[model samples]
Target: MRDIPVLFNNKDECCGCAACYSICPQRAITMSEDEMGFEYPIIDKTKCVCCSICIKTCPVKINAL
Candidate 1:
C-alpha cells in the first residue's frame, strides 16, 4: 500500500492563515515555526484521523496526498 504522506509546504509558500488548523475537527493540525521565520502548519498524526480536513483547507497546495 502507498503511504499517505503528511506534506508540508516550504516557508515561502505558507501564508500562516491557520485555516487548516481551524478546519481540522480532530485538532491534528498545529502551527509551527517555518524556516523562514513564519508560522506554518504541521500535522500531528497521532491525533489525526486521516480525515483530510487540513489538506482541504491548505491554500498553498500544502497537501501532497
Candidate 2:
C-alpha cells in the first residue's frame, strides 16, 4: 500500500464536486455532508489503491494549472 495524498487540506480548497468520488476505480471515495450541509469526499484507505485518480479528477486541481 502507498501513502495517498489528502484530497483537500481545507474545506475551502474543495468545491463540493463529486468528480473525485465518481472517478475512484476502487470505489473508495464517499461523500459526506458537513455541519453546514456541504458535501466532501471521504477516502476509505482500506479500499483505496492510491491510484490518485480522485486527485486527478478534482476540478480545483485542474483549474489550478
Candidate 3:
C-alpha cells in the first residue's frame, strides 16, 4: 500500500461535495457524516490506488498547493 495523499487537511476546506466519492474508481472514498450532520469524505487507504482522481475531483483540493 502507498501513502495516500490527503486531499483536505482542514475540515472547513471541504465543501461537502461528493465528487471525490462519486469519482473513485477503486471505491476507496466513502462519505461519512460529521457531528454537524454534514457529510465528508473518508478515504480507505487500503483500497485506494493513489490514482489522484479523488484529488482532482475535489473542488477544494484543486486550490490546494
Candidate 4:
C-alpha cells in the first residue's frame, strides 16, 4: 500500500474513544496514553492502507473541505 498521511487534532476534545481504533482492519490506529492517562488514537502510517476508515469513524470534524 502507498504511504498516507494520518494526522489528529490534539485539542483535548477527543475523549479517548476507540471508534477509529476499532474500525481499522489493518490495525493502523494504535491507542497511546497521554499524561492524563487517557488512551488516544495514533495512526501508524506505514501500516495504513489509505482506506479512510478512521476518518469515517471519527465523530469529530476529521475533514471539513
Candidate 5:
C-alpha cells in the first residue's frame, strides 16, 4: 500500500494491544515507542499491502461500533 494501513486521529484511540502486529500476514506491523514511551503499531510501508485487517481487529474501532 502507498500509505500506512492504520491511522488514528488521536493517541487515545490506540491501546497498544498489538492485535494489528500479531495478525499482520506480512509481518509488516511493528510495535514502536513514542517520545513519551507509549508503544504503538508502526507499519512498514514496504511490506504492507494496504490490508485493512488491522482496522478490523482494532479494539478502538470495534468498541466504537
Candidate 6:
C-alpha cells in the first residue's frame, strides 16, 4: 500500500488525545508540542508501516458529530 505524506490536514483539527500515538504499533507517531504547548501527533514516515492505524484512531475524525 502507498504511504501518506502527512496525517492531519489542520493542526487545530487534532484534539491532542494521543489515540493515534498509542495505537501506532510501529511507534511511528510521536507527540510533539506546538507553539501553544499542546501536543500533537507527528508521523515518522520512515518508521511508518502504512498500516493506517493512526488515521483510524484519530478521535477528532471519529468523534465528529
Point to the candidate with the largest lDDT: 2
| Order of quality (lDDT) | 2, 3, 5, 6, 4, 1
Task: Please list the residue runs of candidate 6 whose C-alpha ends up more than 4 Å from where it truly belongs after superposition.
Answer: none
**Candidate 5 lDDT over residue span 1-65, tens digit each:** 24556546788889988998899999998899999998999888889888788888898999988
lDDT scores for all predictions? 0.70, 0.90, 0.85, 0.74, 0.84, 0.81
Name the Cα RMSD for model 5: 2.0
TM-score of 4: 0.74
Q: Which stretches of candidate 1 lie over 4 Å from their true place?
A: 1-7, 62-65
- What lDDT is obtained when candidate 2 is compared to the true structure? 0.90
RMSD (Å) per prediction: 3.7, 1.1, 1.7, 2.8, 2.0, 1.8
For 1-65, candidate 4 gives per-residue lDDT tens digits of: 54464446564547677888899999988999879788888887778888887776777645442
> How displaced is residue 17 in candidate 5, in Å?
0.7
Superior candidate under TM-score, 3 versus 4:
3
Give per-residue CA lDDT, model 1, range 1-65, as digits (tens). Answer: 33333545456556788888888898778788757678777877677777766666677764433
TM-score of 2: 0.91
Clashing residue pairs in candidate 2 (N, C-alpha, C atoms within 3 angstroms): none
Pick by lDDT: 4 or 5, better one: 5
Report how far off residue 65 is in candidate 1 (Å): 13
- Give the TM-score (vs. native) of candidate 6: 0.84
By summed lDDT, which 10 consecutive residues of candidate 1 come out lowest? 1-10
RMSD of 4: 2.8
For 1-65, candidate 6 gives per-residue lDDT tens digits of: 77753557897788888988998899988999989999988888789888887887777777664
Instruction: Count clashing residue pairs in model 6.
Output: 0
Question: On residues 1-65, what C-alpha lDDT tens digit does candidate 3 reach at each position?
Answer: 55686878788889998999999999898899988999989999779888888887788867865
TM-score against truth, every candidate = 0.67, 0.91, 0.86, 0.74, 0.84, 0.84
lDDT of 3 at 21: 91
